[model samples]
Target: MHLIELSIAKFEENLCRLKASETVCSSSFSSISQKLTRLQDLHECVENFLLLPLTQQALAQECGDKWINELLDGSLRLLDVCGIIKDALLQTKECTHELQSIMRRRRGGDMSFISEVRKYLTSRKDVKKAMNNALKVRESNCTDKNHETPAVVNMLKELDAVTIAVFESLLSFIAGSKSKSSSWAFVSKLVQPKRIACKGEEVANTNELEKVDAALQSLVSHKSKKSDNTIQVEDVQIWLQDLEANIQDIEEGLECLLRRLIKTRVSLLNIFSH
Candidate 1:
């Protein structure tokens, strides 16, 4: 194999290495730290390959070889991976903050948090619509040349499914929150705002109240188990925390899938380099 082919092979190896790093780091408590270190290593590996002397000569060749062009294309794709990793890092941090905010607000007795949750839930429709449109466009744009097509399609599908699930969880959390929120107003004869004024809120809160007894049977695994007399703020807090955690996890998986797609495409370009 020529110097160019050898370099392309090295690039493919790094692609595999990047995926392997994710698998290794996923099982650990320090996943965030491990991911960052692995990502930095990936950046260095690709950067070094791109800056090699022979690789430069190959790109600068007078003959305009097809292999050289493929190498350039693959390298460009790797640069796109760089942008992806950077954005993923920012998103991971954002998700963490969002998760903590949910926990903090619940402890501080923030009712407005429910309003925010509802707003985001409503926005899910727009998000799904936009994602559907993007998926259609991506499917139409797929060509045999793009080796990342399968992974891209899988990523989009998983994202759509996860988004729907998260939306439903948020709705459930809102319902649970209302139940706990309304437990204080005890005058059953008087029309409660949540119990009667708002149809959606009424069902969510009332239904939750009805299930409080049954729910306790399953709460033995939790740290604090409360009796059926009260709707425990901790119950709502746990529900919200679970929903937030799901969103954070989905974001991470999507980000990783994207990086994998980019890497697969880079490797394909290398194979086609010959």
Candidate 2:
């Protein structure tokens, strides 16, 4: 269980950094690399010892079995966090790369241009609403001081901060390009220019062109239905909502199981003293 617990703690620390900063740097990924190493080691350690008969019997003990259940439940919640954070990281990384590419491109219509700033502003508001809804859910289930702050809430805050930074940078870039003739488009066009057919329709290289088109179609056919480029802001907001609900359930399980473990430990102490 320490494997899961410590990994979660490390993840929380990274999320704290994200919540406090407007940008993610290479430093964040450096820390993540160390975390992945630790997780891999822990997983190997668990597998090496988990199936022993003595270990199985100890896990079956009724006096403290609730702790085991809580640990498993917590691991599931942490996996949910892992999935969401991975998604956010990949999205932010791609967005950062594309924005930089556009920034460095020669000032012309051939590179790329973003949509209006107002649309970005609306998307930011929608993200804020999602963050608020997550908080509302936490407050609804939390009954006492002990249940107030779950790891999920802090994690969601990081997600909110990262998302806001993404849109804010986009808005700034689009705003600055307003006065340029080359950046006059409403929607963006990628750096890859459209293909143009040969003029005059000569048949000298017809076979080679057909072969190239066949190769290109073969490459394009392998693309999946769910590409990152196709995901919407609304899709991310929905994912966050699902993550928040999972956190709520995990927190309840942790509290209940922790109370049981403490009670069992106290009872054992009493029996030994008598």
Candidate 3:
């Protein structure tokens, strides 16, 4: 039990650090990916803690009417969120590959290029819509009924809260920013002479994806010269390729993490079902 308590404390500390380091508004693709990895680590610890004999005995002893119901519900919601996110990533990846192909085979002012950009943007809008729907699942599920539960149950509840928080940030990053000004700023920066100087920092900032998003938007919406449009298309293609690679890595991580989440949920069910 003492060891279980220590493990839970360490998990909470890691969760606090993750929250402090990245936020929904400012997180970059890479940072959010790192957060996903950290979340997996935390869940692994949770699985081990749950497997302990003493921990199982304690959980079995509890009446666990409200607390258990909330946890089981929260687990179901987490699974739902994970599946949606994975599908979104796959959808975005397909759109990205299509856009990259369009950019590769075509040059300036091609009607197909413009068409593909519209499709990609539309896909992004759909993805964000789905993510927002999933996020409505309620963090309150993790916080309610905590005060009256055992220490182990409280720890599990806090873990659920932090897990949901991480997923929320991940979903937000994938969905991109909703603010018009923020999106416009990325577009504006893309055409600037100094944008080349800041290329190194793009991966570390939320604007990495936004840069490609804005560049494509600018290409289609602006009446720039053919040569300028070609250059922008090339830049956008490179960025899209990079994003596709990152998305693949993140998708792999999410799949692994999803399995861990399922395993943890199953463990909980087993403890009380008997």
Strongest candidate by TM-score: 3
Candidate 2 overall lDDT versus native = 0.32
- lDDT pick, better of 2 and 3: 3
The predicted structure with the larger TM-score, 1 or 3, is 3
> What TM-score do all the candidates reach, one by one?
0.37, 0.32, 0.90
What is model 3's C-alpha RMSD?
2.5
lDDT of 3 by residue, 188-271 (tens): 555555665685665356546666676777777763455532336667777898889988999999999999999989999999
- Model 1 stretches astray by more than 4 angstroms: 1-6, 18-43, 62-111, 123-133, 139-274
Off-target runs (Cα >4 Å) in candidate 2 are: 1-27, 62-65, 100-274
Every model: Cα RMSD to truth: 13.7, 18.5, 2.5
Best by lDDT: 3
lDDT of each: 0.39, 0.32, 0.78
Residue-wise C-alpha lDDT for candidate 2, range 1-274, written one tens digit per residue: 4544454465555545544443333222222233333333333333333333433333444224444434443333344333333333333334433433443452322313233212322343343344333333321211132334333233223333333333233223212221223221211121112311231133221222112222222223322133443323333233334333432433343334334333333433333233
TM-score of 3: 0.90
TM-score, candidate number 1: 0.37
